[model samples]
Target: MKKLMNFKGLLLSGMMMLGMTAFAQDGASTTENYDQGFRLGFGLNGGVTTGDYFNFALGGDVRLQYDLSQRTSLTLTTGYTHLFGEDNVPDLGYIPAKAGFKAFVWGDRFYVLGEAGAGFAVTNDYNETTFLWAPGIGYANDVIDLSLRYEGANDFKTDQVALRIAYGFKL
Candidate 1:
């Protein structure tokens, strides 16, 4: 209960900060100087987990990104992941909400990404919340984005490495 409340508060605060940043950026810039300011992306990922209770996991996510510079962007992600259980173990699931930064390394097309946040887990007997993070590399263009990421959570029983594919367009 208390942990859940704290998590909610943190989530709210992060969102507020992002909103304030975006507002400030918008105020400081003119429409003619920027081509397209921000983008929204949706992605699907599937991968294998190597951990105590589960081995297979599948997930999908939506992302909102704002360009901070030509080579860097701020990203926020919300996703759902389902972990398949081993024999005699119940299946587990998570709703992950995260915020992070992505930076292009080799041009506008290749980038490295890192994010840290929390996951709300649903279990058979009880619900739990855990810290979550992912770090990876990716390629992106106007139509498609591809990435491989290792995602994990603290205080949860499992983890995953996923290859994600997404379609993105300007908004």
Candidate 2:
């Protein structure tokens, strides 16, 4: 047992060291060749939702980002989603306010992101305010941003897979 424990510790330590080294050597270690400090972007989003009541969704959003490194950023996002329903069903709308982070995985242009916040129902027909969460993969540059994501709300059980296309500049 003692020998096994020692082996496990050694293996864990080696793995951690390797991970740190790789992280430090990533392509996004520094903010260079592009504008930095802060940025703001405007996005148009469209998607397909769970077919419970609504089938399609469209939205607009604004995002503010601060780059901690060339490949890592903290972000604030707010958006409105309008759901289109079937005949006889009323359209529904939601406003979301979320805070999240983006991390580059392959290079400065490709990344994964996560965000969580609140979704407020804009119409009284669905007056529940729910927790909202999104996880996504994206490509971004100083001028353009594009992402595909799954956005979900807890209490209302509303969720969608969305594509967001955006334009941005430094602030």
Candidate 3:
């Protein structure tokens, strides 16, 4: 358990360092392309969960996004999810790490996204991990992002439908 926690910490730190390096490179670009380069964002979400477990989930995530073209971007995300339990179920928590792509389907502000990764669940009884994925549509601008998504795990019985709102700045 201690080793697993340490490994998770190390992985997150490494990812953050990599993201910072990318942001620094984008910031140092000499061409006008710098304005269209990479960006970093953070978000918070709260919603209800169903399918085997019924609960309220709240989560916060960080994303490093790189523009692939005028209408597309690649994103890497890491977050913590907490599910409030009811009745006999215990409170559950997860650390989700994922990579995805976002593309503007209608215009520069509206997009669709799909991400797949793993979720590490931690609890007093046992620690487990499972495959996780999400598919969603969103609207974004320079300062705000709003999205509705469905999140699920391959090994866990519960899934979630959430609406997330975020505030971000150019990096």
**Number of the top-ranking candidate, with lDDT as the measure:** 2
Candidate with more favorable, higher lDDT: 1 or 2 = 2
- List per-prediction Cα lDDT, in the order shown: 0.77, 0.79, 0.75
Ranking by lDDT: 2, 1, 3
TM-score of 2: 0.79
- Which sections of candidate 1 miss by over 4 Å? 1-36
TM-score of each: 0.78, 0.79, 0.77
What RMSD does model 3 have? 11.2
Off by over 4 Å in 3: 1-36
Give Cα distance to truth, residue 36, candidate 2, Å. Answer: 5.4
- Sort by TM-score, top down from the best: 2, 1, 3
lDDT tens readout by residue for model 3, 1-171: 465447445644643453344333333324346346788889998877765555789999988898877666898988888877778888888899999978766546877777889999876453789898777778899889999877876566677778889887767
Compare the candidates by TM-score and give the number of the best one: 2
Put down candidate 1 lDDT per residue, 1-171, tens digits, no spaces: 465447445644654453344333323324445554688899999988757688798889998988877667889999888888899888888889999988766646877777899999876763889999777778999889999877777677666778999988778
Report the poorest 10 consecutive residues by lDDT, candidate 1: 22-31
Model 3 clashes, total count = 0
